[model samples]
Target: MSGVFIVSDNILSPIGLTTSKNFGQLKKSVSGIQKHHDTALSDQPFYAALFDQSGFIKDSDHKYTRFEQLLMASISDALQNSSVDAGDKKTVLIISSTKGNISLLETESYNPTIQKRISLPASAKLVAEYFGFINQPVVVSNACISGIMAILTGMRLIQSGQYENAVIAGADVISKFVLSGFQSFQAISPGPCKPFDVNRDGISLGEGAATIILSANPKNAQGIKVMGGAVSNDANHISAPSRTGAELCQAITKTLDNAHLLATDIDFISAHGTATIYNDEMEATAITLANLQTVPVNSLKGYYGHTLGAAGLIESIVSIHSLKENLVIPTLGFNETGTTNPLNICTDLLSGNFTNCLKTASGFGGCNAAVVFSKQ
Candidate 1:
């Protein structure tokens, strides 16, 4: 199969508007999370990484919501830097998001016209049309692994000769609906989240958008290559993950096998560490089962909070930069060992020549996805 290369990418978040700006903040151990007491989101004060909309100018013509603006901003940056033509007949657009334009329903202006935009597919079609994509847009909303799954889907399509290029973008804006849902489960952390730490509590909800351009043509694509990917479900629980971590481990193992790489070959792991007890434990067990217990691992949830659908893609782009820069960014907010199985959590930025990286994400409904990338 022909390798899918990440030719261009961008991250629009509270920390910065571009990939380099985001990475620059990460290298400094700076977090975008802050105490927020917005009654619209939650009655109680909570820490969250939110977009700084102070300078945002709403478009009166299109009436694009904040969520739509984020998606467009990130994809616009990526498309500007990429060689792929958005209007090409062979190019595709894939959108990954758990909830797209759902917040519009909460406004007093909600009506039949607004109701039509609540559907994920409808939002994707709007984005596709905005970008002038010739092919039908694809939407992936399978829990938190949606971003990684979308990237994997694009890779398969390009490798199968179905599309020559794919512009994948994901975004999720924090809303009262999402905030209250996690609050009901007591999954909201009062402060910054501490992933894989003994005193870790829960996740700090965040909102952001990310875009990655995957192309079969490697010309001008001096970036990381998408080697392989796999998705699996444990069918263990509705909201909880598999206790044994076997399901996630299977996905990781299969991804590595498909990439023709060994466990030891992976220099680092970008884990889906939400800082929640069950999630951290399950991920630790999975890494151990995959014989990657010793590999350096880190989670960006501490810095960016959990950005839901955009987490996987945003983190993957950062990992690609980490490989290119030969640096393993620290796992922010980690202090002590917390998991039953030992993990090499980088508490400080470590400089090294990284080659292969493994990015894994697990979400509700027992879904898990893993993707392997290599430095070109």
Candidate 2:
């Protein structure tokens, strides 16, 4: 099997519209999460990282939904920066999102026509057609792990000789339904989230999109590769994560084993630090279980809030750039250790020669996923 390398990428978020711009902001410790009082989203004030629709709009004809608009903008920007031809017969498109076009359900009444429009496959095909993709578009919507799962899906397809190139895009937007659902669970933080911090309470929701283009050919002689990945499920409660980190540890160990690397080989970890009580504790337990407790870890939730589906890919992109730039970004809102197992959380920017990094994500239904990225 051939190695899958990232050729080009773009990030469309409140912080920036390009990957470089987002990385720059992270280096300066800037955050996109802010307090907003929008009655349309919630009756009370809430904090989130959201794009102003009027200012972020690229489509003049309004032919697509907000979700589709994000995917097209991100994909177009990424394609412009890469030589990969998305219209080629050997190219495939993969879309990842927990909720696609779900906002329409709030505005429009439920009907067959509206239902078809909101389907993930339907929205994926429309975006694929707009971008001239010939092959069927693959959709990954496994809760919050959708982003990493989608990336792994693309890597497998390329390694299996099914496609020469893959454009994987992941996105999600905040809506009334989404806000209320989190509110019902009392999961929305009153202010910016504090991942792995003693003061942390809940997650601050966010909206954004990111696109990562992968190809069998390296972008350069020393390009980054999608080395290996693994997924696991605890079969625990649907909404709550595992009481113990044993299952997530299985996924991490398996990923390291698949990559032919030991726990000490990893340079750092880009954790799925949602700032919620159980999630942070479970992730810490898992990392310690894998004998990676000493590895420096950071969470972007403080900067981007919890972007849900986009969280995994967005954080992974930052980590990739960190390797290329030789700088480790700090965890924005972390001040003290709060989990049962202590973690070496990066609190300040550190310069070093990084080679490999681990990206992990856990979502609802007790599902957990892990993927290893290496610089060759």
Query: Could you give candidate 1's per-residue lDDT for residues 1-376 as a string of tens digits?
Result: 8879989999999999999999999999889999998998888898999976833334668667777788888999999998889999989999999988888878748777777878787778777888899899999999899999999999999999999999999999999989899989999877899999999999998999999999999794776899999999988899998999999999999999999999989999999999999999999999999999999999999999999999999999999999999998899999999999989998889898899999999999999999999987
Model 2 TM-score is 0.98
Residue range 1-376, candidate 2, lDDT tens digits? 7888988888888989999999999998989999999999999999999886643445678778988888888899988988888789989999999999999999999999999999999999999998899999999999999999999999999999999899999999999989999999999989899999988999999999999999997552237888899999999889998988999999999999988899999999999999999999999999999999999999999989888878778888888888899898999999999999999999999788899999999999899999998898
Structure candidate 2, residue pairs in collision: none
- TM-scores, one per candidate: 0.98, 0.98
Number of backbone clashes in candidate 1: 0
What is each predicted model's overall lDDT from 0 to 1?
A: 0.92, 0.91
Tell how far residue 91 is off in model 1, in angstroms: 0.6
